[model samples]
Target: METMMLGVYKIPEITINSGIDWLGICGIVLTALIVVLGTWTTIKNFKNTTLSQEAVAEATSNRQFVHIKAENVAKNRQEWINGLRSEISNFISACFDVRSVYLNQSRPTGLVPELFEDFVTVENLERELKSKLIAAQGEARRCLSLIELYINPEEQASIDLVKTAQEIFHRAGDTSFNLTWECDDLVKIAQGILKCEWERVKQMV
Candidate 1:
């Protein structure tokens, strides 16, 4: 018995379970996937919001540009109208001066120096009117076409009168040039027409 008791020892056996809980692992994987999906959705929404803001900004800029362009067009149109009015007024005044000189056989007291100097003879008067008529016609052709749309077509007869008066002046060796009555009539008719046009233009403005 003493010999048998000399070498007695006990050792416990350890076991390891290699099997995994696949369900729990699957749940963890699903949670991670959900987090990734949420992050992607947030990023997409931010990009869409940025694009929408840029579109709105572009639209606003376009509207402003159109508004400014319209304003400039209006301003230019008004300036043209004003210039037409001024030219017409000068032409009318010249007609009146011619009429006054023809009727009184003397310069009017209030006549501008240049007008008085220009109408001293029928030839001078004709030259003055020719220059003025050229300016008036140019303005009418270039600028007043739009304004004429609203005016009476009969107003154009004034231009015809001017042309007729000019022809009379150029009729070589024609003695009617010195006839006060003829010159008076031509100037008067032209004056009336210009006044009518000026009034119409004023109303429009």
Candidate 2:
């Protein structure tokens, strides 16, 4: 009976902590920490994305509008150039609509596909039409200059002819090509008139 009692006392003296129990406690604590941290991170990212997305969209829209307006302005300026020479008596004012079509073509940015593509096309057309128009304007200016110089002091009949040619030059066709043709004729006529005027002036001298 005494030894049995001693054995019972020894059993009670053993540590209450178990290796398995400590491991289980630690695992539970780690699991709870992970859950809390994961939830916080997910919520933060979700909220930030929502707000930032709207701001990004607004910025993109503003840029798109600016680009569109710029394209329109360019179109308007070219049209004005085409129509600038028209007077009250003029009919069928020159309008270079093809210039607008020619204005579209350019490098694209990686924006929404449709808008970006339109901008690119407009730029390319602008470049081509610009070149053609510049040449046409130069030709027309030369025609006008030649008339003013060599055809101004001619006979009254010749003056009327030169003035008619001047009107034709100013009225150069609506199409860029047609305008080019008109300017070519004016150029030829002006050269002929200049030759006559120089000879007549030389004889008078």
Candidate 3:
């Protein structure tokens, strides 16, 4: 060991020959601190990167789910529109058929009442007309039921449509019923509902 002076302070000078190299020891310690700091920084950065990736994955999954749900809703609405339109048309046709049958039955056929053959023929004709009227009425009822099922009770437009459809069904048997006017009104209401649903589908895309 040798003494070195710096102003009023005296310090021991360590050398390799003295079995303790102070400068080399300090260098080793500094290098270890630097390595430890670098490792800690790397670990922190890795955790941040992993977190960012997970966030992106979660966001992507949410978007995909929303998109799929919207597509299904739009598809179902379109199917509903088609089914409702078909049922409404069928109901109107059946009502008209029932009216036609009633009208035909009311009109007198030029058959001699005294002739047994003519009496038998008239009875057969009445039976056939009654059977056809029943079938037409049955079909109209079935279509009306389906149309009501297709409507959403919560919506004002759907409520109005259902009311109109019910009225049409109730009055279909009347010979004096203006079926054309009622059918036109039903069609107008249906068109409005369909158009509104279509616009909602467009917005989802």
Candidate 4:
């Protein structure tokens, strides 16, 4: 009976040892699972951080492109306006020369036989004035075309310039009428051109 009791006690001790080994195995598995989950979470966070930084960098590059385009357009616009101003200045100078030459040859100069030569000089001056007026009209029309191309806002200024140029050409074409008759007409034409140029310069900005 004592031998039977000792064998039964040995079986219980074996059972306890088996249970401790199983517990240790379960603990090691749980620790491995925790390590795997932590590594996956860290990888996901790093990927998300990289993508966000890339998106910000792309947006910044796009903004720079837009700014550069705006600046280039503005620069080209100013250059166009300056070119028109230079053309107008040349036209005004030419008109002034025509007017001065016309004014100087107003009255006849010389006596007897020389009177015929003086008359011829006057006639030649008149012809030169006519040619100048025609040239001025052509240039003024070109100016008007440029203004339209540049999308100028000052319509009244353009109209005034065109009107003065037309008037000068018409009077010159008619031999009976003359630029000397309207001394201020050339100046008026110059003023009108200047006004139109000013409007164009303002629009460039």
Candidate 5:
């Protein structure tokens, strides 16, 4: 057995062996603690990395959804505008035709003598004018319907414009007591209103 001296004392053989054993046990315990701490740190880092990846993925998906929704809204709005433009143009053309037919029918010297054989008769002239007015009214109603379809009813500005157009259309129908005004004048006013609305929508888009 080997004897180890501490300070001025020579340690006994059995005491030395016991001390060595104690030191070995302490070393084992310290090694085990170090391993446990290393394992905990690794697990914590992995958990943080996984959470970060999941958050990034969720944010990307939300961004994509918003982009797609905006694209669809734009497409729908453009289609509505194109359709409304065509309908408004048709309405204006119909109003112009009604004005011309009414003036020609009422003229003493007929505008188209070959087309209107019964232009001199008051009854025939009035009947033709009534038919033309009814057709013009139909076109105007189509314009109103288009406005209702394309515009939000809650928007007060658009609603007021539509009301104005409706009043003008109804006024065009009254030809009582041999009184008639130029239909094109009302039609032109409606056209101006529609163009203004369209310009406002374009700015939003």
Candidate 6:
């Protein structure tokens, strides 16, 4: 053992060495603890940041998907509205054509045996008109079926439109059931349906 002198006081070398060793061990342990704490804090912050970013990305993706789907649906509905309008117009026009042919056939065309050649010509014209009327009726029926398919059966407007259209078709040649009034009603109902759909499309936009 050695003795160290400091200002007339004597300190043992073993005591000095032991104190330095204890201080060094405490310093090392404290440093290791600080490093562990820092690493844990950094890891925890990184995990929180990653989770937040993932949540934001997921929300953005969902909003974009919903917006795109709405646009597609609105576009499709617009096309459907245009198609239904055209079919309804065609159906009404064909019904009117059939009505006109029936009215012409029922009109009085005073003729005698002396005008037999003229009457034969009129008969030929009548046959041509009859053929055209048959074609028109067929076209109207086809359009009616297409319109029914385009409309929702559960809707009152759709039901009324289909019912009026059917009545017009069946009474087109009858000349007694107010086919024109029925057609007008059908047009009104179709207009209502189209207006409602247009409003819905505007909302999506």
Global lDDT scores for all candidate models: 0.55, 0.53, 0.91, 0.60, 0.63, 0.90
RMSD of each: 10.8, 28.0, 9.2, 7.4, 9.3, 6.7
Tell me the tens digit of each residue's lDDT in model 6 across 14-127: 544434677889999999999999999999999999999999999999999999999999999999999999999999899989988888888866755368797897788789
Q: Native-vs-model 1 lDDT?
A: 0.55
Clashes per model (N, Cα, C within 3 A): 0, 13, 0, 0, 0, 0
In order of appearance, the predictions have TM-scores of 0.48, 0.31, 0.83, 0.54, 0.58, 0.78
**Of candidates 3 and 1, the better by lDDT:** 3
Report the number of the highest-lDDT candidate.
3
In angstroms, give how far residue 55 of model 3 lies from its true place: 0.5
The deviation in Å at residue 148 for candidate 4 is 4.6
For candidate 4, write residues 139-184 as lDDT tens digits. Answer: 6456545534543445766666556555654444344556554436
- Model 5 lDDT per residue over 1-111, tens place: 999876857756664343467788899999999999999999999999999999999999998887777666766766666776676566556555555665666567544
The residue-level lDDT of candidate 2 at 99 comes to 31
- Say which prediction, candidate 5 or candidate 6, comes out ahead on TM-score: 6
Regions of candidate 5 where Cα sits further than 4 Å from its true position: 1-20, 107-136, 172-205
* Model 3, global lDDT: 0.91
Candidate 1: TM-score? 0.48
Question: Where is model 4 more than 4 Å wrong at Cα?
Answer: 1-22, 104-145, 151-205
Question: Which scores higher on TM-score, 1 or 6?
Answer: 6
Clashes of 2: 13
User: CA shift at 100, candidate 6, in angstroms?
Assistant: 2.3
